[model samples]
Target: MRFERCRMLFGDEDFEKIQSSKILILGIGGVGSYALDCLYRSGVTDITILDFDIYDESNRNRQIGSDAVGESKVDTLAYLYPGIKTINQRMDMAWVADFDFDPYDIVIDAADTTKVKIEVAKKCYKKLIMALGSAKRYDASKIEVASIWKTHGDALARKIRNELKKAKFDRNFLVVFSPEEDKCKEKGSCVAVTGAVGLTVCSEAIKRILK
Candidate 1:
């Protein structure tokens, strides 16, 4: 049916894996929103999106649902994708502490906050795929998925590396990052880059699960 195109690439048995997989997406901004888009269309039937933030005018340039101001991101995605679960809560390391990650097969960290990314990397029991450094740059081709330690050039990646080191968690994690430097001093984001990173994160999650 709707997943015929996906089933063509991976046979019926493999395509079933995508449907059975449950993914936890931690943000619903520029990157996370696109991740949701790709995962849902790619046949991932089970997903729980978490984000307490509402759509804002400023996010119109890159984030999905930004057109609907004041709309809850969690609810927006659930409504758009239908049948998916959602958590309307502000997430940080503190929130994840009490959270049970048992039902998920993969956790995607698309949170813009550095601490939240660190928390996901440190505490998440399921395999994690995170987005890093998708801001400012317009070239979507620059983004790549690599081990966190092998990532460079992006300021966010450097910060995450340092924090993970301090926490003494040296385990290698896959991250979608861009080596292209930020175009300006101010924090900025664009849909081209963020969307690309989001797609890459979903692709990595699917590959890991199938393997």
Candidate 2:
């Protein structure tokens, strides 16, 4: 069980600590699907999801299952994993303001929406966002992070720029945006790139919680 090393970093007595952990996987598209794979493989068994998107032909480029074309993504995952928890509604932090979300050790935003990332950042203790450079989200010499207006490309960048104009974000907070290295546009959405970013998100989660 050398692979147990992944779980051991958390602590000696918490083999299933991750199993008990509550993770909110927002969006079940390219990044969310792969993010779930990383979390599940790493022994994170408890999860809550929020997504209302039905599988469509457009999703064929990158999604969990090709057969899932006509099914609800969240429902498909629930059916597939059986034990993983799921939420079938889209997130609207304001209207759903009263809903109680238990604190998460790390919140992964594969939702592909800037608004969702901002919502999770405001609600959760820590947040991770996946971004690819297809759109110029401002010019960041390095890929680590960019302020709301710092990014120039990608759809996420535009959305963030708009949000920042409203002055809602906290500059002091730690919000990490990971633009896929090869990017979906240039590299095309390979399971390789998606899987790597997924692994990166989970790796960041481990480092944040364990270190």
Candidate 3:
């Protein structure tokens, strides 16, 4: 009965797809953590989360598992959801170049690094829903999903777009982003905005899966 509500909402066929989909969420920070939460609660059983960083006291404000400071984010999350897989490795170009993404039905890029985001986008544009900058912004309602090419007012998205063009990456991919003007240069974040970004990314992935 864990998924009874989801079953009622999605009906039998779509709910089955939700349960069977292989999802990969990169980063276990403010945005990625909520994405994982939404997917798990919605009956996604086969999930693999990747994050190299451990929790720090500063993360407590917005990130899940922040209580386990100095502990591995992926390990802690996997402990909470034993059904999921964990990869406690950095998302560097070397790793991204070799990692196989074909196994996953959808790859959610909530990772912070722009280089890693671009590499992942280049490798798996077809199955990627990336989360753009959610920091320094307070309005969760401003968050929206759009093609990376069409996104505006997000400096991170603009940077990624320029980089992707330099790399000759022509494909357009979906991204969850807020059009709010960034408040400052400092990376200030809150669950209100980051959590909304994560949930929106999860919603987009689910919509694609059911389609």
Task: Give one digit per residue, the lDDT tens place, for model 2 in 45-117.
Answer: 7777678888987677667754678888888888876678778886766634654655665566666555655
What does candidate 1 score on TM? 0.96
lDDT of 3 by residue, 1-211 (tens): 7888999999999999999999999997999999999999999989999999989999999988889999989989988877999998989999999999999999999998899899999999999999999999999999988999999888899999999889888898999999898888799887999999999999998999999
lDDT score at residue 164, model 3, on the 0-100 scale: 87
**Could you arrange the candidates by lDDT from highest to lowest?**
3, 1, 2
Better of 2 and 3 by lDDT: 3
Question: Residue 66 of model 2: what lDDT?
Answer: 43
After superposition, candidate 3 runs with Cα above 4 Å error: none
The candidate 1 region of ten consecutive residues with least summed lDDT is 117-126
What is the C-alpha local distance difference test score of candidate 2? 0.59
Highest lDDT model number:
3
**Per-model TM against the reference:** 0.96, 0.71, 0.98
TM-score of 3: 0.98
lDDT of model 2 at position 89: 83
Error of 3 at 23 (Å): 0.4
Per-residue lDDT value at 134 in model 3: 93
**85-190, model 1: which lDDT tens digit per residue?**
9999999778988888777899999987898778878877348888887878989988877889999787888898998889888998888898896787776777
